[model samples]
Target chain A: MTYERPPTPGYDLGMSSSPIRKEVDGALLAFVARQRPNLLAISDELAPLMAALDALLAEGKRLRPAFCYWGWRAAGAVEEDLDGPPGERLHEGIVNAAASLELLQASALIHDDVMDSSDTRRGQPSMHRRFEALHRAQGWPGPARAFGEGTAILLGDLCLAWSGEMFETCGLDEERRRRGRAVYDLMRTEVMCGQYLDMLEGTRGEAAVDTALRVVEFKSAKYTIERPLHLGAALAGGAPEVSAALTGYGVPLGIAFQLRDDVLGVFGDPAETGKPAGDDLREGKRTVLVALTLERATPAQAAALQRRLGDPGLDRPGVDELRQIITDTGGLAACEAMIARYTGDAERVLAAAPVPEEARAALNALAVAATARRT
Target chain B: MTYERPPTPGYDLGMSSSPIRKEVDGALLAFVARQRPNLLAISDELAPLMAALDALLAEGKRLRPAFCYWGWRAAGAVEEDLDGPPGERLHEGIVNAAASLELLQASALIHDDVMDSSDTRRGQPSMHRRFEALHRAQGWPGPARAFGEGTAILLGDLCLAWSGEMFETCGLDEERRRRGRAVYDLMRTEVMCGQYLDMLEGTRGEAAVDTALRVVEFKSAKYTIERPLHLGAALAGGAPEVSAALTGYGVPLGIAFQLRDDVLGVFGDPAETGKPAGDDLREGKRTVLVALTLERATPAQAAALQRRLGDPGLDRPGVDELRQIITDTGGLAACEAMIARYTGDAERVLAAAPVPEEARAALNALAVAATARRT
Candidate 1:
C-alpha cells in the first residue's frame, strides 16, 4: 500500500555488519517470500498484515542473530564456513534459526505495544494503531479501536506460530537442535513471565531495587543476550564448559546492555533512539535507575519524584527537574558505576573464555558497543 | 487453588472411555506438575496464572485427544500399547501430542474471549474477566479492564508457547514425528487464519451462505476434527491412502459437529449447553443457519433480523422472536436436514474405510455423538 523500501540494518553499533546482516536478511526474506502466496491465498485482506510485518522486520538490526552467530563461532563453529558452499549448508540452517528470533521479537513487540497502548514503534504507527487507521479509512462499522486491537492480536498470533514453524524447520540435525530448542523454549516462557512481572510492578506504589533488578534479569538481560548466545552455542553442539563460559560472558554484558538502555531511555537524543524523550518515564516503567533515585532522594525530592514519576501529563520542565534530582542524589552516577562494573566483569570473562581468536575480538567489540550505544 | 476435580472425559456416545481418558489425563497432569515448581521459581506471584490454567484445563473433555487417539488406532497403532510398558512409551508420546492440542485450544479460547469481549466460558468467567475481577479485588490502580486484557493476552501467549514445547517433546521417534510436525505446523497456521476470516466476516453486514460455509470449513471442520485425525495418523506413519480415508470421514463429520453446535446454541437447554439459550443469536455469529434465514426471509423480516442480530442487550423475548423468524423461513429445518445428510455421509465413509475393525467402531460412535449431542 505504501512505497517499497529495502530493509535497513538495525542500530549501527559503529561496526561493519554486512556479512552477518546479509545472511540473516536473506533467511528472513526467503522465509517471508515463501509464505506470501500461502497467506494471500488465505485472503487478499491479509496482504496488509504481511506488509506490516515486512516493514517492522526491515528496521531490525539483527542483534539477536549477531549474538547467536558470534556465540556459535566462540564455541568452535568455523568463521571460514560462513559464506562458502560447504559452510552454507550448516550456516544457512543456523541463520534461519537466528532469523526466526526476529519473528519472535516482532510478535512480542506487536503484542507489547497493544498491552502498553503505545502509539508508535520504530517511528511508525504501532500495529494496532495502523489497523485502527485502516478501520477509520474504510469507514467500517463497529468500534475501530476494537477492530484494530483484534486484528493486531491475530497478526501477532500468526507471527508467533510462524516463528515456531521457522525454528522447527531450520534444518539443523536433531541432536544438535535439542539443546537449542530447550533454550528457545525457556526464553519464550521467561519473556512472557517477565512481562507479567513488569505489569505487576506497575500496579504497586513503590519499587524496590531488588524487584527492579529481578525484572531486568528476566525481562531484558537473559532474553536479550544470554539466551540468544546459548541458543547459538547449543546449535553448534558446544560442550558443557563452552556453554557455561558463554553464559559467564553473556550475563554481565547483557545486564550492562539493559542498564545502558535504561540510561538512554532518559538521556538519548530522540532522533537517535527513534522514541520521544522521556518515553519510559511517560509510560511509568519502574526501571532500576528510577528505583535507585527513590532510594537516595531527600525528603522533598522524594515527595516530588513520587508525585511526578507516573504522572502521564508531565512536561519537559518536569523531566528536567527529575533529571536534576537524579543527578543531585547521585542516582545517575551510581547507575553509571553499576554499568562500568558489569562491563568490566564481562570483559574479564571474555578475556579468559575458551573461544577462538577472531570470535574473541568480535565479542569484545560487541560488548563495547552494547554497553556504550547511544541508541 | 480450589478443590481439584478429575477431568471429565469428552462426549461418550455410550462407549467406554476409561482406557483413552486415563492416558491423556495422565500426560497432561504430569506435564503441569513438572512445570509448577519451575514457574514458582520464577516468582511466587505467578502462582495465580498456573492456578488459572489448571482450573481451565481441569474442565476440558479431551475431545481432540480422543479423536487423535482413535485416528492413531485406525491406522493400526495397537490398543495393547495403551497399557503395557512398551505400549506405554509409544502411547504416552501420542497422548502428550494430543494434550498439546488442548493447550492450543485453551490459548485460542482465551484470546477469542478477549476479541469477542465475551463474559463467560465453560460456565465460568473468561480469562480476561477473571483477571479483571482479580484487579478489582486487589484494589489495583490503572484501568482494571486494560490490565485484565493485557494479562490474559500474555497468559494466552504462554499457553501457546507451552503447547509447542509439549508437542516437540512428545518423544516420538524423529522420522515419524517429522510427518506429524508438518501437519502440526499447517494446523496452527490454518486455524489462526480461519479465526481471522471469522472475525473479518463479523465486520461485514450480511454473511452469504457460501462465505459462512467457507468459515465453517476452515474454522471448525478441519481444525476441530480433520487436522487432529490427520496429525495422529501422521504420527502413526499412516500410508497416504489411509490419511486420505481419514480425511474423507473426518471432513463431513467435523462439519456435522459444528452444525450440531450451532443448532444447540439456539435451541438447546442452557443447563446442558453451558451457555445461555440463544447465545449465538445474541452474539450475531454468521453461522450457516443465519445465512440461510437471510436468503429466505421477507424484506420486513430481513430488516428486523438485521436490526437486532448483534444487539448485546437482546433478551429472551428478542431471542424467541428471532427463533420464530428463522423457523418460519425454514432456516431451522434446512439446517437440520444438512446436518443429517452430512452425518449420513460421514457414516458411509467410515463404514467403507479400510480402518481396523475396533477403530472403525469407535470412530462411528464418535461421529454419532458429535452430530447428535444435546450439548
Candidate 2:
C-alpha cells in the first residue's frame, strides 16, 4: 500500500519551475547525454549502465546548484549588475559547473544505498536492486545479489569520476576550474570521511550525541552546503570574508536541512519522501534524533528500541511503537527544536551578510522551503 | 605452505632501486602523509582508514608512473637534454603528477577486490577482509561482512578523489595538469565501464572470446598502459604523432601484460604473483584463456571445468583439476603464443618510432620485464 503524502504549503524539490532549477536539470541531462558515446564505444553491453545513470540523474532538487549559484551572487560577479533580477544574470558555464555537484550527490547516494542494502530510492528500486532484478530476470549465473552489488559499486565509482570530469569540462576557464577544484577536492574527501564516520557510528551501537552531530557536520553541513557555496565564491574570486559569511549561513542551514531529512525519513509519507517508511530505523542510522532518543529512554523502552532498531524485518506496527517511544521521550520534539534553532541561525546570518538583494531573497525562500516542507 | 618465487634472470619490479621507481614510492608515501591530518581532524576513528590506505600503498608495481615518465621523456621536454640517462631527465613536478596515478590504481584494486570478494591482495589481506577482521575483533554490531565492504567502498572512493587532488597539487602548472587530466579522466571512466563489463561477463557464465578480449582492451590495455603514456606525452606538450606512436606501442604491450597476468593467475607461484593460485578461476573471471579452453574442450572436459569453477570452497585438488583441463585443452599454450605475438608487435612499433635512445632503451626493458616476469 502506498503511503499518501498530505498536502504541504508552497513548492517541492523537483516541482520548482525556477530558472536555476530548470537550468540544472537541463545541464545534467546534456552532460549525461554527451558522455553516452564513450561507454557505447567500449561495448554495447554497457548500455544498461548508461540507462541506470540516466534514470538516477533525473528528478533532483537542484538545491546544491542553487546554493552554488547564490554563493557566486553573494560574492558579486564583477560584470553582473546587482540591480537586475536574479534570473537575468545566469551564466551557462557557471550553471553547468554547479550541476556537476548533483553527479557527486548521486554517486554518494548510490553507494550509500548499497552499503545499507536499501531496496528503494526516490520511489524506485535502488541501483543494486535494479541490477539484482536484472540478474534474476536474465537468468545470469552466480549470486544475483553479488552481481547487483558489483554493478552498483562500479556505477557509483563511475559517477564519482564523472563528477570530476563533468566539473572540469563545464566550459569554465582553467583558472576558475583550478580554483574551484580545491573546494571540490576537499568536499569529496570530507564526505567520504563523513560516510566512514557514519558507518563506524552504526557498528558501535548507540553513539553519543556529539558523535552523531559530528557526522551531520561532515557528511551533510559541509558537503551539501558550505562547500558548494565556497566553490561558487572561489570561482567568482570572492573575498575571504565573503566565503566566511557564506559558511556561517551554509553550515547552520545545511544542518537544519539534514535534520529535516531525518524527520522525513521516519515520519514523512513514503510517496512524498520517495523512500520506504522508517528507513533510518531499518538501517539504524546514527542520527542525532536517534542519539537523543536513546539518551532519554527508560531501561525497558531503550531495550524495546534496540530490539527493533536496524531490524530489516521491522513491520509497520514496530515502526509505530518506535515512533511512539521517540515522541513520548521528547526525541522528536528535541529534533524539531534543533532544526528550528539552526534554521533561525542560518536566517539571521543570511540577513546580515552583504549579499545582493536578489540572491538574498532567493536564499531566504530556499531555506524556508527546504526546512518547512513536510516531505 | 607458501609458494617460493623462482629467481628471475634480470631485475624485477620494486627491486631494481631505479631512480624513477624510488621517486614514485617516495612521492606516494609523502603525499599520503600530508593528507592524514585532515581525516584525523574529522575523527580519530578514521585513523584505521588511513592506516589501511597506507598499508595498501606500501607495495605496488609502480608501473603506471613509470609509463607516464617515459611518455614525457619520449616526447622531448624542451628543458632537458635527451642525450642523458632516463634518471637525470626526471622533473620533480612531472614525476609527482605521474605518481598520483598510483592512487587511481589503488582505488581500482581496492574496489576490484571487494567486487571479486578476494581475501588477499599483494599477499596481504584485501581491504574488505582487513575490515572484516577488525569488525570481528571489535565485536561490532550488525553483519561483519557488511561493515567490511562498506569501509572498503568508502576508502576506494576517497582514493579516487584523492588521485585528482594529488594530481592537481603535484606542482605542475595549470596547463600541464589540465592537459594530462583529459587523458586521466577518460582513463577513469573507461576502467569503470570495463569493470562493469567484466562483472557482467562473469554472471553471464562463459562468454564468447570476443567479449573477453573486449574486457582486456578497456580494463587493461588502455587503462594500464596507453593512457599513462598519453598523459606523459601531453604533459610534455609533445606533438600529436608522439601520442599516436606511444599508443601504438602501449596497446600491444598492455595486452601482453594482461595475458601474462592471466597466465600467472593460473600457473605462477603464489609467492611471485602475490595472489592465490587460480584466484581468477575461483572468482569465475571469464578471461580469454577460459573462453578459449571452453571452445576447444570436449563436452566432458568442459563439464568438468564448469563443475569446480566459481565454487569458492574449491580446494587444492580442484585447482589442479582445472589447471590440467586448461593445459589439456590447449588454452595455456594458446595464451602464451598470444603474449609472444603481442610483445613482438609492441617491440617492433617501439623500434620504428622516432624516440630518443635512452627512452627507447627504458621502454624496451619495461616491455620485456612487464610481459616476461612471473609476477
lDDT tens digits, residue span B1-375, model 2: 111221561234323635777888899999888889988988888899988998999888788988898898888863354333443333777778889999999999999999999999988999999999999999987689999999999999999988888887777666777788889988998999888888888888855788888899899999989999999988888899889989999999999989888888888788777888888888777888888889889999999888877888877888999999999999899888999999999999999987877778778888887887876
RMSD of each: 4.7, 4.7
Q: What is the iRMSD of the candidate numbered 1?
A: 1.2
Which candidate gets the maximum lDDT versus the true structure? 2
Error of 1 at A326 (Å): 4.0
C-alpha lDDT values of all predictions:
0.82, 0.84
Where does model 1 exceed 4 Å of error? A1-10, A13-15, A80-88, A308-328, B1-10, B13-18, B80-88
Q: In candidate 2 chain A, what residue range of length 10 has the lowest lDDT sum?
A: A1-10
Which residue pairs come into collision in candidate 2? none
Candidate 1 clashes: the total is: 2
| Cα lDDT tens digits for candidate 2, A1-375 | 111221452234322545677878899999888889988888888898888888888866677888887788788863354333443333776788899999999999999999999999877899999999999999977789999999999999988888888888776676777789889988998999999888888987855788889899999999988999999988877899889988989999989988888888788788777788898898888788888888999999889988888999998888989999989989899999999999999999999988877667767877787687766
Per-residue alpha-carbon lDDT of candidate 1 for residues A1-375, written as tens digits (9 for 90 to 100): 111122322264323644777778888889988888877876787788789889988886677887887778888889566563542367788888888999888889899989988877887889999989987898877678987898888888888888988888887777767878999999998889999898888766547888988888888878888898999999888888877888888888888888888888777777877877777777777788988888999999988887887677878898888888878998889899999998899899989988888878877877877887777
Top candidate when judged by DockQ against the true structure? 2
